[model samples]
Target: MLTGLNVAVIGGDARQLEVIRKLTELDAKLFLIGFDQLDHGFTGASKVKLDEVQFKEIDAIILPIPGTNHEGIIDTVFSNEEVKLTEDLVKSTPPHCVIYSGITNAYLDKIVQSTDRKLIQLFERDDVAIYNSIPTVEGTIMMVIQHTDITIHGSKIAVLGLGRVGMSVARTFSALGANVKVGARDTAHIARITEMGLTPFYLDAIQKEVEDIDVCINTIPHLIVTAQVISKMPAHTLIVDLASKPGGTDFRYAEKRGIKALLAPGLPGIVAPKTAGQIIANVLSQLLHDLVKERKGSSQ
Candidate 1:
């Protein structure tokens, strides 16, 4: 049980509700920041403003999946007030206080480093990424259906980056009778794509491969789908860039070329917040439980 643990959940959407539910059930003391407009209440959670939280007593801090923006501002959908995470606030926390986030930015990373506190980016874990890919694949399917008039069956699809999400996307689309082609730099990934009974090509050959595909899906977080790459694609092809913000595809170029390009990041959260939240909550509960045990052992 996390009975004695004091956790501060700061600024998130519906997913954080699942985290709050699990944490409260474990009997943790929760100070909810930036949830002023939330109608639902939890037993052990106190909805308070940022100033009201006793930072020194905090055993853990939970930031939203997106963490802070470049300017250190967190996205608080439930509150009208601005909840900024400053270095001073992190420094005020107990030495052992852990900060949990789905991802981190340069701003948040610098704060945790200077404060000498632990910062865990939950999405970095393989288990989390793989599990989250399920919803991601489903969301991808949803997007394709919503945007394109053509059926997935027998449509030529190109998936860039053979990462967990890319792999799932390729497999699912192929299973649905789409002529799926996956691009990757690694030889092993190429062989794996072939093993999955799909066409495999190097990322460098993306321009050549895009010539005939009906849909182009990019999972690479970087700018792999540049103007040159998109220029080679058929005008009728639908481009789905699933990377983080400022995704792989060139939005301006795609628009100029008269191709429909959609940038979709955090599809799991949008498509299945409850499942995504439970994935985070389960991992966090285990990690927090481990933290408590470790502290107890050291004290004894």
Candidate 2:
């Protein structure tokens, strides 16, 4: 049991609830900041305000998946409150305190660096991303089925980028009998796509290649699907962009042409909160256990 540890879970959604519950089950004294709007409550976790002094007692802090905004404000969805994750907050954190968040912004990173605080981004963890890919792919397939009249079998599918999510999207679509064509600039990725029995094309030709696409899934975070790319696609084509907010697709052009475009990020948490939370909980448990062992070893 994590008896003496104090974990502050601040500003998150339904998935964060799972993290809080699992932390409580682990016997850690949990302080949930900005969860006042949450209807259901955990047994052991206590709710607290977002003041600097109160946030100081926390030995560890957990922020939501997308940690903060460009303006450095952390959205507490449960409380309907927006708290500025300021430098003051970072400075107030205990020296031993470690911050766990999925993604961090430039301002947040600057604060952490200046304060000498430790930050662990869970999304960057290989195990978390790899496991989460399953739910993401499943949710994506569900979206594909719901948004279009076309069947996955014999569909002309274009998967942009060959990263973790891209590879998963392509492989799954291929397995469902779609003629998968992956767009990538990397030579290795092109080779890998070919080895996986999928066609690979360079980004320079994406505009022409997207002509008859039934479904285009973009996993790249950048703006790969520009106005030119969208203009070439058939109006019946469905674009599923799995990238983070302000996704890779040209939503303006898609809407202008009456094309169906869906941005489905955080699929794991939205589609399967329980499983998603458990995945995070399991990883957190291992990390905390290792940290405890390291502390004991250093003291000895």
Candidate 3:
């Protein structure tokens, strides 16, 4: 139980609600920042302004999945307040306070480093990424169905990158009877793709692989699907770029070519908020509990 722990949940969407609920149930004192417009309330959570939170008493700070933008501005879906997490705020927190976020940016990394506080990026964990891929794959399948006139059965599909999300997407599409081909830079990943009974191709040969693809799903964060690559694809092809914001696809080129392209980063949150929230809440609660135990042991 997080009996005496004080936590500040700052800036998030519906998924944060589950985190708040789980923490509150564990008896953590929660200071919910940037939730002014929310009507429902958790049992042990209180809405507070950023300036009003007593940072010295905070044991942990939770940030949204996107964490902060390049400017340290947090995304607050339930509030109109423009919340920004600055170095001063981190410095004000107790020396033992740990900051939790789904991901980080240069701005967040700099401030955390300057403050000398531990920044735990939940999305970096294998369990989180693997579990998240489930919803992501489901959402991708939904998008492909909605946008395409052809059925997934026997459709030529190309999945770029064999990371957690990429592997899941490729496997699911292949299971659906799509002629799935996965592109990877790593030889081990290519071998694994072949082991899975799906066609494997080196990323260098992406142009040739995409030439007749019905759907191209890119999980690589970098720009792999350039104008030149898009030029080789059939005009009826659909491209789903699941990387972070400003995904890998050349959106302008895809548009010019009259090809449909989608940038879907946080599909888990969008397609299954409750499940995604539970995943986060479960992991976060255990981590916070462990932190509490560690502090107690160190003090003794």
Instruction: Identify the candidate with maximal lDDT.
Output: 3
Model 1: per-residue lDDT, tens digit, 90-196?
99998999999999989999999999999999989999999999999999999999989999998999999999899999999999999999999999999999999
Model 3 poorest 10 in a row by lDDT: 204-213
> What is the C-alpha lDDT profile of model 3 across 52-133, one tens digit per residue?
9999899999999999999999999999999999899999999999999999989999998999999999999999999999
TM-score of 2: 0.94
List clashing residue pairs in candidate 2. none
Q: In terms of TM-score, how similar is model 3 to the real structure? A: 0.99
lDDT (tens digit, per residue) of candidate 2 on 147-216: 9898999999999999888888899989999999999999999999999999999999999999988999
lDDT of 3 at 254: 98
Overall local distance difference test of candidate 1: 0.95
TM-score of each: 0.99, 0.94, 0.99
TM-score of 1: 0.99
Task: Kindly indicate the candidate among 1 and 2 with the higher TM-score.
Answer: 1
